[model samples]
Target chain A: MGDIEITELRKLTEFIKQEFDYDFKNYAMSSFRRRIQRVLDLYKMDSVDELIRLLAKQEFFFEEFISEVTVNVTEMFRDPTFWRVLREHIIPNILLNHNKISIWHAGCSSGEEIISMMIMLDEMGVADKAKIVATDVDKAIIERAKKATYPLKNMEVNRKNYLRYQGKYTLERYYKESGSEAIINPSLLENVSYRKHDLVQGSVFSKFDLVLCRNVMIYFNQTLQNDVLHKLHESLFKYGYLVIGSKESLIWCDIAHKFIVVNNEEKIYKKIKD
Target chain B: MPKFELSTKYKAIVIGGSAGSFQPITQILAALPKEFPVPLFLCLHRLKHVRHGFVEALSIKSNKDVIEPADKESIRKDKVYLAPANYHMALELGHFISLSTEELINNSRPSIDITFESAAYAYRDKVIGILLSGANKDGAAGMEAIHAKNGMTIVQDPSKSVINAMPNAALARTKVDYILSVEEIIEFLLELDKKYRI
Candidate 1:
């Protein structure tokens, strides 16, 4: 694992933004450098300059860069305690507020959260009450999310997480296992729309009752995080709910005053002001 | 071993351990005074799903606040920053903590390598890295990184560790500054605290 100096990193990031039109300029510097090293190792390159030159010469290799940088790793029902809270507390309150609810799954990689939310809605007998808009910056992952088919090896982790979440039924009941893939019941996708919307550059598509941008902003610097948070705020209705990643918070951001902490431990906040 | 003054000013301390390390970590934290000037980082391997109680358990024995830092939190003095479960916590330039869910390195999410390399890259020779007992080779590369950056490196004496694999693996990787038993490790910390005061 070779290291990328700060100046080399800035050069590569600037090159990508100017040539490829993908803005990694505002990413968290330390992690961004490490991810670039992964690309370098993958291509057997020795320096950042080589990576930049190859990316410039080869047009399609840009996708490889996107895949490396935005790795979008997710598991079903991650942080089971948060799911328990969402099931027992947050959902019921959101149900009381609107007869029909809308949820924006910002950075919804592989649609696990949407699937988890659908299961929760079905168990709570509110499947018909919500519409889900799941978006990722990568269209390829958006396709993967819509298919909702996962490797069979990953099901064990998902099943354990679902059990910890205390689901009403075993997770196996929701998906049929083929030889190597577990294809989730496609009916769950009926109420969900999948799109490729870049959170960093794209405008708000709709107002959601609950906007879930979980664990996605850790890749961004503080400036980009506040920018994304504001976008999430604008995408939500007044007095609506905002759920960030468990380790992420709103207290330190510029918009902290507009939202009140609904559950500090769970990282749930309610918008008190638009 | 030339002491290298044993009193050089240090910016940060990163300690990583796994199996059979909890008691020694507790003793080290318990022995350090509340006004400890340098920021301490602990990246112990633990269960991924159970996120709540580890810090609280450690805080019970220590006077300093034992916190699992939020992503991008400012590195501050007088705090025991425990790496949270399931997230790889790394140090950044300008003294910030960065967390990521990058693919598991050496079958560990909080790979000891990630934290140690980041701290070494950010602070270079000003950081002190310590590796302790564990069941795997996760911290070996980390110890090497610290050594390459000229940071002070310490590992628990492998013979004294309940599981010798971790410390022995690190010793196999690089030349360490110290190989101390758990008791000596605690004393070294207390003495290091006095150096910070000077």
Candidate 2:
């Protein structure tokens, strides 16, 4: 985009904040610009100004805009090694320290990772003792995640990842597949709650034994990332575990000294002190 | 070839290429002075799963520091930042690089378009975008984005590229500022260093 377009986008972001009370000023500008451009193209609007006018006039347009901007790209048991480490090392250690576990999957888009964690807990005989909360900025995706029915076509990849995770039971055991959809057994999500929580703007709702915020911080700029990391740090109980995306690092943040590396390769860290 | 003065306004250099791009990229990096003023981002497509040893190979050939950036790492001058495989790398506000596993654009992770477009958006006219030898059209729209932002755009001369499809595709999309051979490109970098370095 040109300078004029960028300036107009800045104005649109400010307008959204003032009118809709949704603040996007801290988002990484490149991805924000790309998503805004996509919204403009999708609506066949000439510019950000046009989109701003439409958003002000129509309520439904805001929903579409929010859905478009919040990316819900994820899969079950992604990076099997990380899950293996979680199962063999992290979960077992957490169990030793606490009688009951509280887990939070921040930016839990589509509920894949939360389901994976629940299944793992079930296998470990700790499912009844664990309470999980999964959240995202978009309510629409959280609703889809609540349904827990995924297309059958995605099962192959999910199954492959599960197998690589060395899952004792076949993935099919957790879900009943019929026609084009596979609905996860409702019992798995019994202790889990899905909610809409903006990581950037939302306050810490509770403390947790573990916080898995993988791949979400990549969409934020460094200052926002530092702020979110501080919040995640504040949200974790003493000695709580934090797992981020495989490619993401915490070394650059001011909170680096507050956490000790539990597994550098997997990007897992432990809160060192209160 | 006629010589042109390098613009002092440029703050960052982004070079993107794919299949058969390594040789020319190495040549250009080797030609650049160790004290080259602007930071450089290298987005070359490579095998996704095999992650080790790429930066070392490039480091052996280039005079400046070459490293695969950790996600959210701050961008620095006199260093070559290689896009890690299996992630779409982008610049954030011209200060740091962010990596994403979002669905691939143009069927490649570490997509050239993402890096180029992000750099263009972040740096505006203070960016230089170079599309080098490659087998696909991933960088075409990115070059256009840079042109639209008034950033300098260069494409390798198609005849000099081992894989001409990339440069030809970029040529088709926008009026590139320069279409130089690999040797000329290296010379141009050297000229840029001479003109801009303090």
Number of the top DockQ candidate: 1
The numbered model that scores best in lDDT is 1
What DockQ was computed for model 1?
A: 0.80
Per-model C-alpha lDDT, please? 0.89, 0.87
Q: After superposition, how far is residue A121 of candidate 2 from its true place, in Å?
A: 3.6
lDDT of 1 at A201: 84
**B89-194: candidate 2 lDDT, tens digit per residue:** 8987859888887777898988999999888878888889999999999999899989998899999999988999999999999989999999988888888887
TM-score of 2: 0.89
lDDT of 2 by residue, A141-200 (tens): 898889899999888878988998899899999999889999999889999988899898
Interface C-alpha RMSD after superposing true interface residues, each candidate, one decimal: 0.9, 1.6
Candidate 2: misplaced stretches above 4 Å?
A: A1-6, A122-128, A151-186, A251-254, B1-5
TM-score of each candidate's B chain against the true B chain: 0.96, 0.96
Interface root-mean-square deviation of model 2 in angstroms is 1.6
